[model samples]
Target: MNDVATPHDSTALVTGANKGIGKETARQLADAGLIVHVGSRDPERGRRAVEEIGGRARLLVLDVTDPESIAAAAHQVGDLDILVNNAGIMAEDAPAPESDLDAFRRTYETNVFGVVAVTNAFLPALRRSPRPRIVNISSGTGSLAWSTDPERAFAFSRGAGAAYRSSKTALNALTVYYAQALESAGFKVNALAPGLRRTDLNERATSADGDPAEAAAGAVRLALLPDDAPTGGFFSWDGTTVPW
Candidate 1:
């Protein structure tokens, strides 16, 4: 394992960091002394967030779904120690028979394809870091084990968000694959179930009372994990393991 430096000199990029959990994760990482890149689709929002997180914070105008944007952003960052894939979209998918295919396509475009694009684009920079960490912001709803439990809300919803949930499940698969492939290279790739935080991801999340900062703290924990820490694992906000 390569443990070369601490957050004091590390650099991190948190996608969709204009607001919500992404923003909080960037803030906390910056507070921990990492040079943080607040990535947002909107330059104005991203700049505003950078200003709010003044210390070692810079704005990165990134549209994860856009190939040009991802490539440009990756080219701009010469080196990176941490990557937090926090940009995701949720759609209110109906039951299997009535669900919209377009919704599924849109959801996968951002939650799954977008992550692959961003990660691959930044691979060169991340490889340059002695201790590289990649944190994927996933949801507990994506857990096949938990979703099957009768007491779980995901089960109760009867596959209401089949598209979004399945996309996360795919993301979990990607996490494991990336970790296995990069283990020898000293990269820690993991997924985080941030819980149902108060964010604008969807109507339910916006009305929810969970603190984005609390969930973001969990993400930061994964981002700065020690060299020997577990990789390709799903963890909750409190640092406990979650079933795949």
Candidate 2:
């Protein structure tokens, strides 16, 4: 990994930042003058994204699924002002109910467990910052109340992906638990649903009028929240609070 000094006193980390909403979040953060670390499992892609952002953007090789990589990235980052848990995977296809449990396990390995690993690993660095924030890139699909609604649009498309949706639900729980634990410690931890952005995760162009940049805005807002902002809450791209 290529290690470099942070250009600003406030540093932010965005996992899966090589592309999609993650990349857009990194770019916007960097543009706003934060020292942004674009985390990617692939070193080449991470470096290229940092270069493209063209500011205080740096590269950190982080594969949330790997413990070694997570630890190494935490050590490399030293101190951080923001942590965006944006890396996640969706199953390639819906598996039979009795089919391989391995597929569901693997999805959780990255979506749920990875968040725990990365957040714990980076806690020390986050605590060091005067204004620390943790934003989990969650989904509207994770909302049991919404996902089960017959009239909800996402419910129609998200019904088949049990592994992915369940993993995110677990992630939402994680966000609240951590937020409570860190509430007195002065860190704002929250989850954000980027809406349906056209990204590789869905294998389709983001729905009409969907912009990854628009989705990233919510994450950026949380990452840059004032010290008095609310914690342990779920929010949407437009800043509306979501049910836990």
Candidate 3:
């Protein structure tokens, strides 16, 4: 029996819910008794996911990179309490000098700009709620502290993942800005480093990369944070604070 009653008649939308972490996040949120909108760029895929979830999960066709798609999806979501910006891409893991401008454009189009577009479009619906929450699926690579630390393993390649890494950092900035802007209105906006889960974002991520559900739990926690919870914070899947 799903007994967790989310606060304030909470309703949510999880983007990129067709597969991987996004799908898992939707499942958990629905399990928590919230009406979850499974946002996907493809209607068929979204339908499949909604079938898989088999709860209060609705299908929403949203392509974050497209203005029309974002606007249309927002129009349908009349009252939303949670917004999970989980759609992202890693075009190429090339170093700064070796990276193509087009690749960076593609990465930022989804990872950075997409979040802003979706958030702005949903602001009206979110504002109608008594307690609104926004969770950005960011990465640890975005943390300047970890990036600059010479001791970190990934620090070995100072120039690796120029496109994807920087996009996440930019996402982190947006999280902070959104949190500050919406805090007064009872909105909790935060970024999460779900870790390098075993997803299709890259060729190397396989089953060994880790379970996507593990990371998705973090999104749910952020979405359900209490009224006194801190906003504009970066947190790990384990609920520990991540340095910005």
TM-score of each: 0.96, 0.92, 0.96
Question: Residue 120 CA error for candidate 1 (Å)?
Answer: 0.4
User: In model 1, where is the ten-residue run with the lowest total lDDT?
Assistant: 1-10
Candidate with better TM-score, 1 vs 3: 1
- What would the per-residue lDDT of candidate 3 be over residues 1-244, giving only the tens digit for each residue? 1122255457999999999999999999998888999999999999999999997999999999999999999999888999999999999989999999999999999999999999999999999988888999999988888988899866887769989999999999999999999889999899999988999988766555589999999888988887878889999988899998
Q: Predict model 3's lDDT versus the native.
A: 0.91
Off by over 4 Å in 1: 1-5
Of the candidates shown, which would achieve the greatest TM-score relative to the real structure? 1
Model 2, which residues run further than 4 Å from truth?
1-8, 93-99, 155-158, 205-209
Candidate whose lDDT is highest: 1
Candidate with more favorable, higher TM-score: 1 or 2: 1
Cα-lDDT of candidate 1:
0.92
Per-residue lDDT of model 1, residues 144-169, tens digit only: 99999988778898777888999999
Between prediction 1 and prediction 2, which has the larger lDDT? Answer: 1
- lDDT tens per residue, model 2, 124-241: 9988887788999998888998877888875676456778878888999999899999998898899998888888886654454589999998888888887667888899988998
What ordering of candidates by TM-score runs from best to worst? 1, 3, 2
